[model samples]
Target: MNAQTVIVADDHPLFRSALVLALRGLLPDATLHEVDAFDALQRTVESGIDADLVLLDLHMPGARGFSSLLYLRNEHPALPVVIVSGHEEPAIMQRAFDFGASGYIPKSSGLPTLALALRAVLDGEIWQPPQLKEAPAQALEHRELAQRIASLSPQQFRVFMMLAEGRLNKQIAYDIDVTEATVKAHVTAILRKLGLVRRTQAALLAQRLLQAENAALEVPAAEGLPVGEDDDA
Candidate 1:
């Protein structure tokens, strides 16, 4: 049998090392990879490595909360991702599930617990803390937002992210190596698909998404869990 491939994307070396050690014990035949930044994580996944699973951290250098998760779900829907975060709040974990995460394991969990969660997820079962149940009303709103974000084509998604970064059409065009007119077309499509009129409105929506992510990151670290963490993949 082929060895399973897994990527652990987190910035903190010590925590990542501990997690990697646990994963190795749980998945003896697995080949593991580590990435400390979001861009590197994206590149690793996009390189077509046939990754079986990804363990992602939410507040990595290049990604904000849910953005990277949404990107992976949109771009590589088949790959399983389990978010490992310090924020074990029901709302945040439920949002992850609504956004299509295979599992949500709080950093406060012990290695044994993490192993059990991974085992369940690998067995094709969704795993989450019992307390992380979905709230229907809030779930509907988050699901709608996730769907809207996922609807963008790869190019359009890139353009949308650039817009969120406050890039103007000319700047976006230059970055994507497209003409400004083409960038404008992408912007229009993005707005229409998202049911918005002005670019600023879209930008603000993006900003709010980012703010939510930041807030989650700021959630007082799980009482005794290590610091330097937030959202997982």
Candidate 2:
């Protein structure tokens, strides 16, 4: 049988190394790949790597809260993703499961519990901490918001995040290698899909739903500019 391929996506080098070491002991025959950022993880997936499971970190660079989880679930439905996060809040774990994570392993979990969670997920079973309880109403709202964000096309999603980061259309265009007009078009589509009327609203929604701390709602200098433009298109 082919060895299972696992991708570990986390930004903390020390913790990521520890997880990889634990994984090595747990799945001795499995092939493991490591990525330090959410964007790198996305690129790994986009590279057509055959992966059996993904160990994702929620607060990695280029990701926040459930956005990466939602995006992965949407773009690669067949790939099982297990969130390995430092956020040990029950609500966060419940939100992870609600967002379609195959498993949730807190960073504080002991080796045995981590092993169990990994084994269970690798065996195609959902796994969570024993202490996790029923989902709260806030979880449902976040899940709905995630679904709406997931509805965006991959490009639109990228633009959505960039918008939240207070990036202007020209900056986003430069980053994504698209024209300013194309960026504007994506911004319009993102607004329409999210049922919003302005760029600031989209930015605020992204920050609120993703729980992104660094992203700010920047008002563009001109109403005609992309980041602050109204949904006239």
Best by TM-score: 1
**Model 1 per-residue lDDT tens digits across residues 1-233:** 23689999999999999999988888889999999998999899989798989998887897877888878887888899999999877778877877688999989999878878888888788997866755334546556766677677878878877766778777888998999889888888987887765676666566666666533221122344332111110
**lDDT score, candidate 2, position 59:** 78
Model 2 clash number: 0
TM-score of each: 0.81, 0.74
> Which parts of model 2 have CA positions greater than 4 angstroms off?
61-67, 134-139, 167-189, 209-227, 230-233
lDDT of each: 0.78, 0.78
Residue lDDT tens for model 2, 82-185: 98877777767766776578999888889999888887887889997876745344434455655566678778888887776878888889999999899989
Q: For all the candidates, what are their Cα RMSDs to the real structure?
A: 9.3, 4.8
| Quality of model 2 by C-alpha lDDT | 0.78
